[model samples]
Target: MEEMPLKTAEELEAECLRLLHANMTTREIQRVGIVRTHADGSGPNWTYNQLYPEPTPIGKHDAHGIIASVAGKWALVA
Candidate 1:
């Protein structure tokens, strides 16, 4: 019979965390019941989604802007 190699400490830690997360996801699913398993697009999220912020447009004056007159009229004079 052939013996398999043992995992290193780092590998063990990573594997343990992976298993824990899998178990938690499974438990959450079961607790929520089968009918509502996928109710949320996201599975019981532990983190909020602000990693990538919503794109904000820069003011035209800061970009490829035009000049405005004292009369509150804008023209392509810039």
Candidate 2:
């Protein structure tokens, strides 16, 4: 099988922003947060925060899918 192309940082950011805008409310966006494992498959690596206008947290499964999709690795999943 052919390998999939990785998304650029800008493209990933844009897609994330689009998802937030489409699925989250203004309040939810402000409170949005993402957490992921480190590259070494250890525990959580870091956390990020920003001022926006939302209040809901993204679910783990959804977060995994989003990350995979943006990274262009979705097709590798069964």
Candidate 3:
């Protein structure tokens, strides 16, 4: 299935957290899909670093960085 579109940053963060927990199975295509959905195709420079602590060198960020960059900016804290 296609990735879901994310609205609030909190929702993005929650999903990122879930993916981060599955880092061992994370993939590039999946990463881009998650980030795209999280930012709603905005292509923001922000990232999701908190999720993938040791992601392999890719482009500007890892899967976690993609999620954290945007989600961290507006994610609602508990």
Q: Once model 2 is optimally superposed onto the true structure by TM-score, how far is the C-alpha of residue 14 displaced, in angstroms? A: 0.6
Candidate 3 lands at a TM-score of 0.32
Clashing pairs in 1: none
Let me know the TM-score candidate 2 reaches against the reference structure: 0.38
- Top model number, lDDT: 3
Query: lDDT per model, in order?
Result: 0.23, 0.39, 0.43
Ranking by TM-score: 2, 3, 1
Please identify model 2 stretches exceeding 4 Å from their true place: 25-55, 58-65, 72-78
Q: What is the lDDT of residue 52 in candidate 3?
A: 30
Highest-TM-score candidate: 2
Q: What is the TM-score of each candidate against the true structure?
A: 0.27, 0.38, 0.32
How would you encode candidate 3's per-residue C-alpha lDDT over 1-78 as one tens digit per residue?
A: 343333544565556656554555444333333323233443332344333334455522455454555454442322
Cα lDDT of model 1 by residue, 1-78, tens digit: 232233332343333333323542221111110111222222221111111122124422221111111111211111
